[model samples]
Target chain A: MKVGFFVGCNTAFNRPDLEKAVRYVFPALGIELDNLEGQSCCPTWGTMPSIDLVGWCALGARNYAIAEEKGVDMITVCSTCHGSLARTAYRMQTSPEVRNKVNELLKEVGREFRGTARIRHAVRYLYKEVGPDEITKLLKHRLDGLTVAIQPGCLSLWPKEVFIDKEEDTFHPKVLRELCEALGVSAPHYKQLLECCGMGGMRSTDMEKSFRLVERKMTSMKKEINPDLIVTGCSSCLIQFDTSQEFLQKKGRIYFEIPVLHYMQVLAICLGAEPKMVTGLSRTPVDNIIKRILQG
Target chain B: MKIFEDLQTTAEIALVKNNLAEEIKELGADKLLQCNQCAKCAATCPLVLAGFPFFNKRIIQAILIGARETLLNDISIWACQSCNRCTDLCPRNVNPYEVILATRRMAVREYALPALAVEGIRSLYDVGHAVYLSESGNPRRKLGLPEKPPTTLSFSNALREVQAIMRKTVLADLGIIPMEESANF
Candidate 1:
């Protein structure tokens, strides 16, 4: 099967290592990926979406049109991209007036949003297209004896009607957990597993308040799961968890640090991609986890 | 921690600012009045837990009471994660996240937005990515990826396409950022 890889801003810039990981794994698994050249931002919440609903759909439709013209579905590792683009398409399809207005704007560029394309979260895409049992067979390395804290991230499982690949239970999500299980790891439950990572707009606004959320989540993970690492499905949550612990530690907000990686990065290592190409840019030291995983 | 009981009894804060709720509806919160104040959205909102004074439920209450200036002056509205958790749990189908977002639209017109929000918009316009970083090249190179991913960054025509599309949006009319005719992109 084939899909367009929606390389969002954070994955492209802030965490290209994750970008590299996705690039490595998809081809290895024999799923062809189209670049969807000239694809723009999802025009995140703080941008067009905050400006106006029609404007939000217009910009999102621009990106959506790219995949539609390519005649393929899209997938993103960023929850914000999935949420924004999914909701944008949902709006375009639900309202004829909004669809006509967005298409009117798209006419300037000689493109129209036909609403045939869908943006699937990368993890969800894998779970649906390539089931976990097949994934387990493809692993070059296994994560045996490792315990993990799972972060599904908000956009992956919320406002369920808009998403094409939704959780069976929104609040009590289990897809990420089952995906982790395929790697031969134990992903136990934590209270703040589904809480927002204070990434995106919240982090961009009041960082101190944003870190308060990280503090709460890390605190819960420490008390409840106390896993060796944290694995998240969303790139925003990945960035927040991978980058927040240092500032949080210096302030004495927490006494310990847990290494973090996006699920794709770990899977890349399991698929035998080099660690430096996947986890090299990590802020929190993941060398130990790398050594452990690679040893198998 | 006051919890917005009866719209806060502060003498300095005014209520019923006259059709602020109506103005918000025009902006996109068409279901702004459908809310029955069940507070389920607030219970599920991250902003409320983050100690922000104005959040999903409270922002709706503030707007319903026509508290325009008060909502504009507060930065809490900008901090919403837009997770739609509040939107998911609301039984009345109010879509409280849209209310907070509509409040942001009103705030943007009045120039009540935070500096970073403006920066994000400017970046979105200039680079086609809301969170562009010039220094990301070296790190990307180290990872064996190109200095720029095959996004609008690497392709000039792509960047121009994004600029062309953004020009037709309400953002162009609001004049929030300098959408230059000849930007250095």
Candidate 2:
């Protein structure tokens, strides 16, 4: 099985370690990942999509055309990418006029969005395609005695009808939870599990307000489950949760810290990828957790 | 920017009737009339939870009252995470999130966007990604990957394709960012 890798912005620039984790995990499990050669951003919420509908769909269609030529679906660890690309595809597939205008924009670039390829979130892809059973069979390490609070990044699950992979009950998504469980960890519920991580537009606009959201989620995680680690399926969520703690602590808003990792980073460690490459760039330290995962 | 400061009196509401709502609908919130002020969207919106003065319901309220300048002058619209939780939970099928986005489009036309949003658009035009870090080379190389991940950064031609596509969009007329004609795409 092979797929195109659409490495979105935050993953490539803000946290390349997550990129390394994805690179390490996919091939280790016998799924070949194509770079998709010329993929770009999802154009994220703050950019094209917010500016013009055709521009957003045009950029997305260009990326989709690259994957279509390869005759495989595209996948990304970033939920923003999953949301952007999937929503664009849904728009074009449903509206002929939108597709025509987008295709006209793509026509200048010598490409066309045939609406053939779909964008898949890497975690959801693993959950549905690889299955937890096949995943456990390939692991080199396990997370026994570990408890986690899952941040099922808002974009990956919501506006549910537009996405390729969806939670049966979007209000209560379980894909990220079950994926964490496959690693031998106990993933539990948190009250603010579905809240936005204050990334994208919110973070870019007013970080104080952004931190308000993440701090609320963090407080809930610390109080309700008080899990050993925070596992999220979105790259932007990883950046927000992993980096905002120090500021939150400095403000005396929160009294504690919790280590955060994207699910792929944790999977990479379990697959025995070097910790330095897979999880090194985290802001909230993961030293003790890494040590524990390696010892077992 | 207190929202109630822009609250329309009965006479003022008669003078400005549904103008902003029509503009929002044309921008992409085509289902503007469907919203019945259910406030179901407001109940679940992160913007509301984060205490933004104008959230899904309030933003709609602002639009219905033709508070164009009131909506534009404030940064609350920019703070929307676009998580679409409001869209997901809305009983009216209003897709309140699109209304937020449509409001953003209206702001862009009036040059009311935040500097960071402008920076993001500038960055997207230059790098084919909205969030490009010039200092990412060392971290990427330290991880045994290329200096630039295989994106438009690694492929100059792809960057040109992105620029060409950008040129054809509304961005061209807005002139929010510099889109030089360097590529034949």
Candidate 3:
């Protein structure tokens, strides 16, 4: 299967290792990756989407047009990108008025919104296209009984009307859990599993309150599951969990540090990719997790 | 008894029936009035749990009552994570997230937005990406990847198109960023 890899800003800049992991794993799993050159930001929820509907849809159409022109569906590792782009496509396809307005605006940029390409998150792609059974067969190293706390992130399961891969039960999602299990890791249930990571625009708005949300989530995970690592499907959540643990510790709020990894990074490690190349550069130290994966 | 009377008088004075709901509908949240105040949104809302004054349910009620000044004065609207969990769980399909966005749009028009939100918008216009970091290339280079990923950062033509599209929207009218022709990428 071929797909255009929409490496949103965080993965491209903030965490290139996640991008590297995607590059390593998708090809290894027999999915061709196109860079979807000249794509812009998903514009994020706070940027264009907050401004106006037409502006949001127009920007999203421009990104979707890039992959539609390439005749391949777009896939992103970031939930915000997946949410923003997929919602735009949904509006364009479902609302003719929106499509016409967006297309009229796009005429200036010399593009059109055809809604031809499907937008998929990387985990959903792995779950739907590359089944867990196939993923297990491709793994060179199993998780070896590692337990993980899952952060599915809000966008992957929300506003289910727009997305192509809606969780059967969004309130209690199984895709992320099943994906982790496929790699032989135990992703146990936690009360705040579906809570926001307090990332995205909230962190920019009020760091303290945002950190409080993360603190609540991490406290729940520490109290309930106390997993070896925290795994997330979204890049924003990955960054939030990876970076916030240090702040939470320094503030004397939390006593323990839990390692965080994106699903792609874990999949890459399980596929035998170099840890430093795919999972390094995390703010929270991942050395112990790396040692566990390599030796255990 | 006197303090309670004063509070009641203030609430009565604060009530104004403006076209706030109508304005939100124009902004694409046509379901603002459909909210039943069920608090399902508040149940999952981080802003509400974080002790913010106005969250999904309250924001909808405030808008329903045309509490424009009340909303504009409070910074709670800006703190929304836009997680859309409320949107997912809303049984009436009220889409509380869109309601919040509609409120934010009203806030932006009133020039009531926070500086950080303005910065986020500015970053998107200036760099063609909302979260662009100049030093990010160093890490990409270290990862055996191109210094610039194949985005608008690498393609000036695409960035220009993005800028051109922005120029036609209400963004140009908002004048949040300089949308002049010379501001070309």
Report the Cα interface RMSD of each model, rounded to 1 decimal.
1.0, 0.9, 1.0
TM-score-superior candidate, 1 or 3: 1
Candidate 3, after superposition: displacement of residue A68 in Å?
A: 0.7
What CAPRI grade goes to candidate 1? Answer: medium
Order candidates by lDDT, high to low: 1, 2, 3
Which pairs clash (backbone N, Cα, C closer than 3 Å) in model 3?
none
lDDT of 2 by residue, A132-206 (tens): 988988889999899998998888988899988788999978888888888999998888887888887888777
Sort by DockQ, best first: 1, 2, 3
- Best lDDT among the predictions, by candidate number: 1
Instruction: Classify candidate 3 by CAPRI docking class.
Output: medium
Which consecutive 10 residues in model 1 chain B have the weakest lDDT in total? B6-15
lDDT of 1 by residue, A1-296 (tens): 89999999999999999999999989888899999888888989998888888878988998888899899999999999999999999888889998999899888878889989999999999999998999999999999999999999899998899999999899899888998999999999989888888988988888999999989999999999889989999999999998899999999889999999999999999999999999888999999999999986
Model 3 chain B: ten consecutive residues of lowest lDDT: B7-16
Candidate 3 structure quality by residue, lDDT tens digits, A100-154: 9999999877898887888898899889998899999988888878889999888
Q: List the residue pairs that clash in candidate 1.
A: none
- State the DockQ of every prediction: 0.72, 0.72, 0.69
Residue-level lDDT of model 1, residues B138-157, one tens digit each, is 99998888898888887887
Model 2 CA deviation exceeding 4 Å by range: B1-16, B183-185
